[model samples]
Target: MKAKKTTPQGNKEITDLILDSIADGVFTIDQGMRITTFNKAAEQITGYARREVVGQFCHDIFKADICFKMCPLKHTARTFESIVNMEVNILNRQNQEVPISISTSILKNRKGEVVGAVETFRDLSLIHELRKEISRQYTFQDIVSKSKAVAKLLNILPDVAQSDATVLIRGESGTGKELFATAIHNTSLRKKGPFVAVNCGALPETLLESELFGYKKGAFTDAKRDKPGRFKMAAGGTLFLDEIGDLSKGTQVKLLRVLEQREYEPLGSTSTEKADVRIVAASHQDLSSLVKKGEFREDLFYRLNVMKLEIPPLRDRKEDLPLLVDHFVRKFTEKTGKRIRAVSKRAMKRLLDYDYPGNVRELENVLEHAFVLCKGPEIKTSHLPENLTPSNHRTAPQATGKTSRLPELEKQVIVEALERYGWDRSQAARELGMHRSTLWRKMQRHGIEVP
Candidate 1:
């Protein structure tokens, strides 16, 4: 054989350069599962040199969560199919758990025979950290939920809290509109200042105005001396206006001035006082509808809608029911001095099946009722309120058996897939045509128990 000088411009060298240039870890293994090629990224991410890792079995080089049962690369090689973004945790040389998303495909020779498998994995440590931070940051006070809808709201809530914009929390009655307003205030820059709350619907027109903007001496027959109103009480903080939709037309005009000019006059006072308080208004009714009906002031509606956080009703976030139930159980357990630790399977199923018209508030009340009845470590069906009972037609739970029907079918699919694939989640997910993470979430959501 004649020796010839070859440049790095060759296709093989160019391909190697491209692979090394990328950040994702890339490695190829032979049919015997021995590493054939290890890129620079693979070496960096795994803390293994190319010379050290090459020729070593992948399972030996990188210990992964699925190494024992559901190896994605092995599945890819056996099926000759590519797997994309299978999330798994692996231990690096430092023995620290590193989250990663693996994408794998079988390598074929020129004869179209499967010779080996190639895998590309990206480190998800930063992403996992961000997700954890989001969970910690968005949760304020006792507002806890695992539903993506709530999570999405919370993800942006920190930004909303940091600003001085007026916030309007709209949701169904008992959907915790006021709670959200409180959370906004508690998380805001004015957290150190006082938070004054008032129910606009609770007071009549004459009393409402006087209550909001305090009356001066002899302003009314009962007025004896000058008094500070909610605005004054919440100076440099937040004033939570509950049920602002019920505000009278006259009051709305005054509120508009306070929003526009950032100033308002006290009852019977000619001079205006600068309003330093931030407004966080809440209403179950639609202010936009009120505007269309010529009831709520158009300008006032815009002012209030500057920063709207419309919370989803309880029926929409049923996935969070279990978490809410747990929270309530813990709360009542502490208050009543009971050792209640769990809700029975039947009781939990019933709770999940119910359409919570009153939202999270109603769930709390139901748990309180259950706590009063339950004297054991667990909450059973008997401990549940009569309204939560299946016989109670007013609040039917699983009458049509369609409440958790989707999840039930989904569970069946996962179980069947697992059985068919001999308990290989990687192969099952591939057969089901879903990302491994998506399958995992679905499994968790459906509460599928493996054999």
Candidate 2:
């Protein structure tokens, strides 16, 4: 009934109201790319009156960096159908190179004839300034954080790094344990020495032993030549033992001796070699709990726990999301050679609200995933992973950079489409290019009951 009541005048008023109410600048153009409509937001952003821009060419008004090549609006009008989230720097009326993210959608008539195109652009000048300030504030090697927990840890890291005492870093999987270890090493007295890392869980007990302590020639069947273990290789520097909880009891004894006597021997050699490396160990499993379970050596655990650093998960420090998002967007943009500059308000809202059980690594993966699907300068809601949708759960499989979970993704798209259409199944079906009956059937298949 509501859809039926949307007359031409009613629709125009609704469109005008939306454009005025929204914070992003919006404009429309005819098939010839002549500006047709300029919203209040556009007037404010570009410092131009709607009267002045209505009949002018868009390129003349904005002077976009991509007007000559890879123009998003041109692409949509020429061959492509839509342009969602293309970032471009445009000289405004003041001649300032203001960065803005533009999303374009083609307008069509009842007979599906292309009539015009509408564009929405959000000013990113303030965001850029804020990103610079935050970057200056949170800079610590490769670590970019704005959370109080990390800030406090960063404050003490120099002191922690100065000490030669054994350090134990604890956190969930995907948390940057080795990053902390490397930071400690880079800040320590042995900053110039090699920072060697070995994963105790990645090898069998024999291979791990050989891997930690260099084996003499003929130590094993394929022992071709002498090899220095991570400890010896890291002599005068730091040796990071990752997943130390996975070490066997026999290997634990060897490690405990290395900690106590400050020495270790190769696989086949009899004489003990001096252990000059500083030990920084990390584990996802709680070593204290492992000790209680009798799976870990209490003595070794005590030695490693001399200076413990627990990195909080992403959900605990969500205040860092905006900064982290910006950091990742810039990073991936460089790697992909794309000009993507920002995230849409709706997509960012979903990112802020969701619980990241996978922590910062998962966050990186999400952005990487977005960077792939996003063809424009911004990451839109439709570009995000399906599991990140409000209708999905964190436990759902991450379709990160892959189409492995197509059905789940399809369901989420349908749900989002329905929500966008105010839960009107007919409208949603029309937008999705499917029959209303098909939409209803798919909803039933996905168990999506409308409220």
Candidate 3:
């Protein structure tokens, strides 16, 4: 049987039906820049009816950010080229700024004469919201982690911020102590004020005191002018003193004075200036141990330890490894404009097996090195740093016979106990005759996540 040829009217109806069925907004403009056709999706996205938009000026209806400057449709029409997935913001009838990605193509007649242009645009608001939601899951105030240890600190951070007491943050190097300090400043009542940070360990003994308390003109050979110190610069906000344990004994006396009396004087200056900044200190060394050894001043330690926070090292919080890896992948993707999907399973296992001596900072560097070498969507084990090889993995002492299966048996028992108690870690810990922290640590070691 021969099929009858469809008429022009039937073809026009079919095209209109297809346009209405599309998920993206579709519209066409004439040579005069007037809307010639508007589909159902266009009306839905712009909050305007087809009848109201047809024959109207495209710019007047669309109101896109680039309508007058570098319009995609105009560019396509003039260059005889197509623009695909160019992101732009547009104002809807409700006057809301809606993010959308638009593609444009030149519309031509049968004789190859350019008569108009067609554009297809998709709403990106939902995608942006989803990205924000995903970011919030493993991130708190820009500090990324899913470990219970970090979560516990985050829970009390608001109260700590409100207290305005001197804070001493203890953590290994590269554990993101400054991030916590910044979080405290950002959440405090003085959020609108400035935040100044100085590394006590990074400066020399002579420069450290002058840096913290500034120096008057002609105070020393290098004294140029009267300069404001970190305390002055951070007057209404926070002054983060990093590696406070490195401060010399004499410098510690000055710092203790400032903390106790809230006053200090610049070198070669007679009068004292009132200090108004909140102090947040960090130290990688154990201050208590240093105090016992007479290396760190006991008076200064007592003053700085008012509201203490201890950040756990990356090795102890291995459960956050996957979340941190995914975060770095997303971060580097944006920074390098590469569309990396994920770290491969084998590569992730290699990452999980390693004990990071340098903590989160080392993990970030490892991922960044992988990003530089990776050309594909997934980062493979081969792309990791040479030092991350399987040979460098931490191994337990050699055990023979029944002892070899102890870890496997222990993991199985823990899993069974947690399952039997409805995944209530406390209940399971009690049932297993272990402390909650011990059970939690075991769970992380076994790679168990809450279901």
Candidate 4:
């Protein structure tokens, strides 16, 4: 610099500095396809030093016989001026293929004659990491519920994580039963194993059976190939069966056998395979009463009810509403790339006062809708659904005075408690000065939601 050096060394230094500053890897290849320039990022990406890569054939560096096999490189080079974007797998020093997105442009001399090509590529590893992190941070635990009932459930989670016991989760729809199931699976010793879930009520009895137990090839009209059932796929893992109360009697018998024998035979297959899965069944229906009514199997009910966990509804967990709102605000902000900061107090009070029949799921949906509709940073009553807004009109209870019996009153109280605390039964039971299990029993006897 003191002598204002004009040698090739000065030009090469400037080029290296420019390439090193770029986040993406950069490489240059001459007309003969030999790598002439390899940037620092390129070295990091390929796990090869610049000295080792320079002067090597570009195809050899990428472990490809020809770079233009599926690429537009040849066309771009012939045209002498064009930019192309493509997804390609490039081999590293260890010969492992890594996915990358490459952007290539032709390099030309000062007289406009094509000389070589410059390619910039970004590694896909960072994208995969960001996706995984986003998924982990959004599910279940992020759902806030401050009711002591929910806290108790959270406290027991660690214990549940240590066991492979069959768990039955009873709750109303939208009470976060699936979230509890996922949390238990993720926290358990079998976290690395598959976590398969099915909604029993969503499918027909025939489809549900086949879905759970899988079928051998030619087992049915559409069974072209043998399929691994959820039970088989979830081996050494956890299977979450939602709406278990809706399972038909025949399916119940099969499930009971799987539970008792720890093995099942696929449809149209003679050989029996052992199942190494932990069952976590949930329902929004009263299974005990259904059993007594001869609708559900008593033996199966007893087997599943061994370690029962009840999730409280949103109304029962009113204290957690604010926390949930805040969490959702941040979540939707990042999701939509909006700047939403808070929910209005008056709107929040209305939300707390309302009886959320749909439970936590409904609350989340409400927030999501509000986030989309809100015009400012703060969410307000105007952003909420019409049905949730306070109105002068009221609907009479379906039950008449003649039907206002003890069971009816109990059911009403339980439902109201569920609504008040956002469906948190533990807090509701504490408010009633009775044990959670006792409350569950009463709810069952009164025919209230207790899946």
The numbered model that scores best in lDDT is 3
Tens digits of lDDT, candidate 2, 377-421: 889989887767453453265757755665776687789879987
Q: For residues 261-316, could you state the per-residue lDDT of candidate 4 as single tens digits?
A: 99999998999999999999998778999988999999999999978898887777
TM-score order of candidates, top first: 2, 3, 1, 4
TM-score list, all predictions: 0.58, 0.60, 0.59, 0.58
Q: What is each predicted model's overall lDDT from 0 to 1?
A: 0.83, 0.85, 0.86, 0.79
- lDDT at 207 for candidate 3? 85
**Clashes, model 1:** 0
Lowest-lDDT window of 10 residues in candidate 1? 387-396
Worst 10 residues of 3 by lDDT: 389-398
Backbone clashes in model 1, listed as residue pairs: none
Clashing pairs in 2: 85-376, 85-377, 85-378, 86-376, 86-377, 87-377
Pick the winner on TM-score between candidates 1 and 2.
2
How far is 355's C-alpha from truth in model 3 (Å)?
1.0
Q: Report residue 393 deviation for candidate 4 (angstroms).
A: 5.7
Q: Compared to the true structure, candidate 1 yields what TM-score?
A: 0.58
TM-score of 3: 0.59
